[model samples]
Target: MLRLPGFRVASPTTIAEAVAALAEPGARPIAGGTDLLPNLKHRLGAPTVLVQLSRLPLRDVEVRAGALCIGAGAVLADLAEHPLVRAHAPSLARAAGLVAGPTLRNLGTLGGNLHLDTRCRYVNQTPLWREALGGCLKSHGDRCHVVPGGQTCVAALSSDCAPALVALDATLTLHGPAGARTVALADYYCADGTAHTGRAAGELATEIRVPLAPGPRRETYVKWTVRKSIDFPLISIAMRFDLADDAVAAPIVAARVVVGALASTPKLVRKLDALRGQRLDDPATADAIAAQVGAQCKPLPNLPYDADYRRAVLPVHVRRGIAALVAAGENHG
Candidate 1:
């Protein structure tokens, strides 16, 4: 049985108070606790103080101006059921609904999901198991188990919300003891999985703002995992497309393909630009673009799936996402 290390728990009612608590040494903020609690049990993470942000009124979903503002503490179940989220950012809603189970979805917050710790098969194990293997690069060792002689950590970013938000071009608002700042969602993750998040130690993600599209944009999220439930994605793809009136000349814009769970950060395969000016009806062009995307991804051997298998499925996800978007466009027309 995994045991949680002893720590002081503090619930702050205001964002300011929470920020102050997080500024202290060995202090960490907790929202939902779905991700943090398990890490604590595994001895992967420990803090002298746990600052709970549940009391901070950061759980509202509202349409502000032309953007949808989702509070950081908003639960997954709430976001999944939100009308605006369902209509404007259905990919995000779909990803949230598929996270964990009904009970966890009711408690896990968007911020928690966005800031989910990177995972590695070798790292996410019991202390005894990890100790037996001489620890991993992400934990107590200096060498990466995934890449052998590689100097960098090769842990996989398994967050479901990240790719969905990246596809929508969302912006994140972060607050800290110093002040607040906003950044594009794409900039929130780094290339190194060990230090995947670009957020400062004292900063807390306060909200996520997704700008509304002028016309309805079609989007879909497809995740390939080892299991049907409670399993993190082995390879997740989120694709968004803006359609043209003709539906034959071009898409007006091509789909933004964000591939997750295969790399340190969700990767946007810009090579799919081949589809920008082509109609989805052209099977040859679509297949060519899918082939380009498949070649761009380099999955490593870390997660539950084999690297080659994940690489092979990239085209499948791209094809499925594009097909769904095209069908949605046709329905709208």
Candidate 2:
């Protein structure tokens, strides 16, 4: 049986205290403990102290001028069902509801999902199993098993909500010993698997702010995993575009296409100018856009799905997300 390392729990009552406690050596902040607890059991993470943020009043959901502010500690289940989220950011709600099962969603938080760790076939194993393989690049022992001769770890980031948030043009608030600084959600993750998030040590993500701007915004998230219920995303896609009206191609004021679960960070597809002012009136153009977005995804053999299958599903998921957005445009947009 896998056993978790002994660790002390540091319960902090405020955001200030939470960041202060996280400044200690071997300390890690845990909210849901859904992902962290399992990592602890596998001995993948062994922090000496767990600085719990449960007591903090960071679960408030507010609607400000042209933006929605969601506290970090807000539960995934609540976020999924919240009226405001369902209205303003249905894609975000869908992404949250799709993470794991109902029980996990009840415990999971938006912050935890944003800061979810990178996962690999070789690294996310029991201690004995990992030791048997001489450890992978993420464990800092040797080369990456996923991509031989690779200079860096290629562990796949399995965060289902990250892509949705990034596509929504969200901003994150992080508090640490150096005080608070806001970062764009797209800029929060690094490509390196070993230290995926660019967040500094002792930092605690406080909230997520999504702008309700450009008017008539349309967004949708779609994911395909090995299992329909609780499994992490194998190929998750979220597409956001601002349309002039419910028309298919209506002038796109802003657009973002993101692919997750295939790389250390959700990839924001470049060369998206083709989507601007171009209506989806022609199927060939839509297919071309999907192909262009899929071309940016870099899938590795780090997850359960075969690399080829993973790659093949990205465009399909993107197409589905766009279709969903088109269908829901009249209602929200």
Candidate 3:
């Protein structure tokens, strides 16, 4: 049986107290434990202390200063069904709803999802299994099993909410010894799989702020997995379209497409500004955007799925996602 290493737990009632506790050496902040517990059991990390943040008052979801402010402690199930989240950021709500299963969604938090650890097929296994395979880059070995002599770990970022959040142009609020500072969700992640997030050591993410769209907006989050439940995305995609009006034929003022489960950092498809002024229902619009997404996203052999198969279906899924958004109606957000 897999067992968690021995550790002391500290439950902090205030954010400042929690930050201070997390600042100590060998300290880790734990929210839901949905992701962290499993890794702990597998001996992936063994922090000397676990600082609990459940007592802190950070689980509110409301509109503050024209932006949807979601406490990092907000439960996934709550956010999935929250009216404010649905109306302001539909894609985020959908992504949250689709994470793992109902039981996990009930336990996991928005912050936990955002701070999810990157996963690689070789790295996520038991320590004994990894030892037998001579340990991959993420497991403390010299070379990367996925890239063969590649110095960087290419473990895939499996967070379902990250792509959607990025597409919505969200920002994160983190508090540490230095005090509070805000970072763009788009810039939060790095390419290194071992440590994908740019979150500083001893920092505690307190909140996520999603700016309200100035005009009508339509957004969707789609992913393909081996199982309907409990499986990470194989080809995750999130698309957001800003429209001039809430009409099916409304011209798109701007658009953002983000692809996840491809690398440690989500891939933001570029050259999408050319998609401006096109109707969401226009076939040419989906075609052009889909083409760009496929061209830019190159799936690696980091996950269990075949890299070529995931690459082949990326554009197909992108096109289908756009079509589904149009079918769902206008101004989904």
Worst window of 10 by summed lDDT in candidate 3: 324-333
Against the unseen true structure, what C-alpha lDDT does each candidate score? 0.83, 0.84, 0.93
TM per candidate: 0.95, 0.95, 0.98
Which lDDT tens digits does candidate 1 get at residues 199-295?
Answer: 8888888999999876646677888777888888887888777656535335536567788887688888776665665666567655875787788
Candidate achieving the largest TM-score: 3
> Residue 140 in candidate 2 has what lDDT?
45
Across 215-293, the per-residue lDDT of candidate 3 in tens digits comes to 8888999989989988889989999998999886799999999999998998899999888798989999999998999
Off by over 4 Å in 1: 246-250, 328-333
Q: How far off is residue 38 in model 3, in Å?
A: 0.4
Best by lDDT: 3
> Which regions of candidate 3 are displaced past 4 Å?
331-333
